[model samples]
Target chain A: MDDRSFVAAQDFLLSSKTFWTKQIYEDLKRTYEDAVARSGKTPTTPADVAAILEGDTLYRYFAWLERHLQRLKYAGRYGLVPYHDERRSVLAPPLRDTGAELSPTLEMPSYYRRVDIHQHPGGVMSDELDGYVYERGARSTTPLMGASHADLHHRFTDLVAAQDAERVLYGRILDMGCGFGKSTQPFHEAYPDARIDAIDLSGPCLALAAHQAPSRSSPKVRFRQMNACATDYEPDSFDLVTSTMLVHELPPGEIEKLFAEAARILAPGGRMVHLDFHAIDGPFARFMHYGHGLRNNEPFMQPWAEMDIHASLSDKGFTNIKVIPFQEAEGVDLENHAAWRFPWTVIQAELKTGG
Target chain B: MRISDSLILDRPEQNFFADPALDRAFGVVMALATEVYVQRDRVRALERKLEAAGIIDRADMDREPSEDERQANAEDREAFVEGLMINLLGKQQAKGAS
Candidate 1:
């Protein structure tokens, strides 16, 4: 099919999703609320919400759309997989083993190679054009983000900048799990003086990150293949260690290890911030999110939501720990938004001094 | 074997509905959504053809949808879920809480 038809199909699907989010989701939530009220018990766990609302038709459709609409979006007739597969030769140039602009050889971790991770067929590390596929898939990942999706990275960069604007720049910045440089791009642009070391397990992704870097006098960012949990950096090296949507992909133990690594790498009084899904309002929301984990092939999401991150960060000697909701775009209220949206939260912490 | 290998054709999908009738009903609604998407592409193709044939002006084609059209879009979505609920509700049992 032509690009026009593909675009048309994708747009229509998005409109359907908007309807699902705006109209149908409100219906489902009201039904759930009414059920909970009649049951006379507030749901404290995902199981509690599921026990009440799982059988409801509205909730079932909401759950089904959350799963299959995304599947169809990527694997549909004019989906990302088939479209990119057709353009393999054109997409493969960035993946060439060039003279050290990217990693010399890929060392993919066993844990990284394990799951498909967001039902992307082969995970981002395996395929040559997987980076291209992921970038396209991410566009519609949160349909609610709309055009402001571009602002998510920039908005987050500003939040990090607000921590200590002047001191934050020109120091070492590490972006863990920097997929195709989407998370890394804003940091480099926002802090022109800062030195950035962006790392992920996927060499192809790293190559794409290097290829897509904006033309400049010199490269400000270096994309490398490194697991976040275990790194090759010296102790107390970086001024800031940050990740966007990375922790939820990792297992609980791996998340803990990553925090320890972040602590190990950050200098005294340095900061670390991560943007991920965590601020679930109630058990109904939790039920939907946990179901999303299973339906979307991400096993770690529920566990991460269920994790007590404050306690974990305290154990890692991190101070000023704060996990609060983040408004991704303007006027999209973080609180009391009826439609479905990612539970965007900023997990910020500072490494304790001289401890 | 690698995940990319042809041996593994299908991975896991949503099978939350235990009842076969409910499962079939849900599948039907999904199929309906798919067909609607297909039809939408056809509509776009027809519009493009008309625009190309000099039978329809750009302004005519780009005219904003009227209030009736806007209302129809919302009502159709509401009616779709209303009709779907008839087939789906009362057919499922609240089980598997643990």
Candidate 2:
């Protein structure tokens, strides 16, 4: 479908809430019941039921439900509030000098900690299910991922064409929180010489990523289970490090640690790019973001948006920090074309000279 | 539970459109409801298994749902669907603005 029709479809889906409540929700409930019955256990609580179907396939199904729900929801509330509420006390800027000390005891909150919920069955986050959920969700929405792939390829190709862009050619590349390897695989194709490693805390997701990576025939990229804040890799090891839609999932303190980790892992002159949401210049857009975070249980999204990430990276001894607003579908500048697109952005930074 | 009593599932702070927490809650509920529905069927199928295993008394296991209980369950489902619709509408509004 063309862009306009895709946007229309998205709008229709988002606006019709009752239909989904009756149909989709019921179907999901039925499917989950069927799956659990097959598993041979009767769960007394919701948590127990989740535990029963806690795998990639189940996660994909959950993701499918989530995306449809999100799509329906997104259509109705476009540009309502600040996507990030920086003024809120919970989202107040982090203390600058938290230091290089990594707390071994630091653990995520119980609700936020577990790998299973984060990578819900049949959802985009469940990498173990290949790109089934991710690809299908994107297709159902508006060809955003398909467009993103084309955009990334174009962007990398353009960057490669530029003079003095030799670094894009080779070196170890790390994709932090590389769910199902969508972002990671493209880099491998773009820079065939680079040794790529994708990391996440979910084993199922990594398993899916590993399984899917081979089809691209891009040197069989390595997928590892590792926290974004702490990694087993040596310092200054990677020439390029990237993450997509990950930072918003982390609280402000964790984001600081992530920057530190990226700083530690990147070689001199290496760059880091994170694809995520941004603060739109308008109040309506900003309000939408704030509401989105609060309603969506993206606990850290507001804080992450309000964060002076450029300054944070600077403090982490990084230079040339920039948050570039790109199209969710095209990854192109929205201001340039006024294409009705998702409000996604990318923040790119480089280690400063003589840092 | 009284069949006449109305059950209301209210998510006061929940934003139907953009809140992932609500979305996750919805997902969990969907999964739970699905699991429960499936379990009911499984119990019917496993009557022999339960009798052989002696998890339930074979004679008592045949008890049917009471009229009141069935009415209460139907009410609960209706309430759940209603709340879900409201949440879904809120979400749709949020999505449209984006």
Candidate 3:
């Protein structure tokens, strides 16, 4: 298809997604509320909401639109897959010069290899240009972000920066699951002096990350193809270990392993932080979040949300653990925010320093 | 690193509606809506280009069509409706045959 055709089709999908995010989602919530009110019983869990509105036409429409709009964004005619696949040769060259140290022997995890994460046809690792496809797809992932999609990453980086007031965290930083370097770039910019090793299992994503990364003037930022759950790095190597939107992609057992890995790699009294979706507040919000996981092809999101990160971190020899809601934008009230938004939360803990 | 067939997967099937056919119908609607949007955008682009090139005045383009032109357009509109209705008509005919 022509460029204009693809652009228009994608724009239509994004517009439809905006409607689903706001109008349809609000209607579904209202219907659920009305149903609960009439039932004269307080609904407390996802099961309760399911019982009330499982068969409601509006809820069906909302869920259907959520799933299909995402599917169409990647698979059908004028989809991201076809658009990039057609021009793979042009897109593949620049990505190679990114200086990514890709590991040939690193076996792909079944959890990641099996599901097409975020409903991107081949996931980020299969195709040569899947990184480009993912980058484009992520731009409109949150319709609320609109034109300032990068603002979320920057906001997250600022939060990480504010954690250590006494010292600038520019010493031996490691970014886990740094997809295509969106999460890593902000760190590179924020901590120019820090030796940042950004790692992911997706080779294509790492290549793109390294390619889009800042110039080699300092040459501190390095993107490598490595698993976050188990990396080859020596113990106590990094001053700070962080990941954004990564933990939710991992299964519960694997997330525990990731925390252990972070604990091992991090220096004593070092910080371990992650920005991921953990459903806060009532069960209707959680019902929507888990349903989003199923529809979006992110199988691990529900499991990851249910995980007890605070206790898990404490068990892994971490102290001062904090699991709190993160406001990704300026005016996103944690207590009362409307529309379908990810429960952006910051999972932070510190390794106890050796006396 | 490698592009293996096994590494990729087809889109996971999700059934929100009870009837699979209804799910397929919604998919068709979205696909058609995307195409419709593309066509609408192209028409707008064409109109702007024509106006910019001084081939047509903005006011004149906005004006109502002549009786003959209106008659021709109405026939085209009917043909468009018929094209969409053909599938339903075929299904009805098959039901009668059965």
On DockQ, the candidate that comes out on top is: 3
lDDT, candidates in the order shown: 0.79, 0.55, 0.86
Candidate 3 lDDT, B1-98, residue by residue in tens: 12335434564467888888898899899889998999998888888999999887878868998998889899889999988888775455444634
- Number of the predicted model whose TM-score against the real structure is largest: 3
Whichever of 1 and 3 has more DockQ, that candidate is 3
Q: In model 1, where do residues sit more than 4 Å from their true spots?
A: A97-107, A167-170, A215-217, B1-13, B20-39, B55-98
User: Model 2, residue B70: displacement in angstroms?
Assistant: 39
What would the per-residue lDDT of candidate 3 be over residues A6-47, giving only the tens digit for each residue?
A: 899899999999998899988888898888888899988889
TM-score of each: 0.84, 0.53, 0.94
Residues A1-355, candidate 1, lDDT per residue (tens digit)?
Answer: 5666567667876877888777888888889888889989888888887788877777777777777677666666656677677678877875675221454465666666777777777788778788888887788777777777879999998888876656544378999999888888788877777888888887777777777766223466777788889899999889899999999999888999999999999998888999999989887788878888887878899989989999999999999999989999888876678887778999999999973
Name the DockQ score for candidate 3: 0.45
Give the proportion of true interface contacts each model preserves, from 0 to 1: 0.18, 0.03, 0.62
Rank by TM-score, descending? 3, 1, 2
lDDT of model 1, residue A232:
91
Model 3 bad stretches (over 4 Å): A215-217, B1-12, B83-98
Model 3: colliding residue pairs: none
Q: What is the lDDT of residue A332 in candidate 3?
A: 82
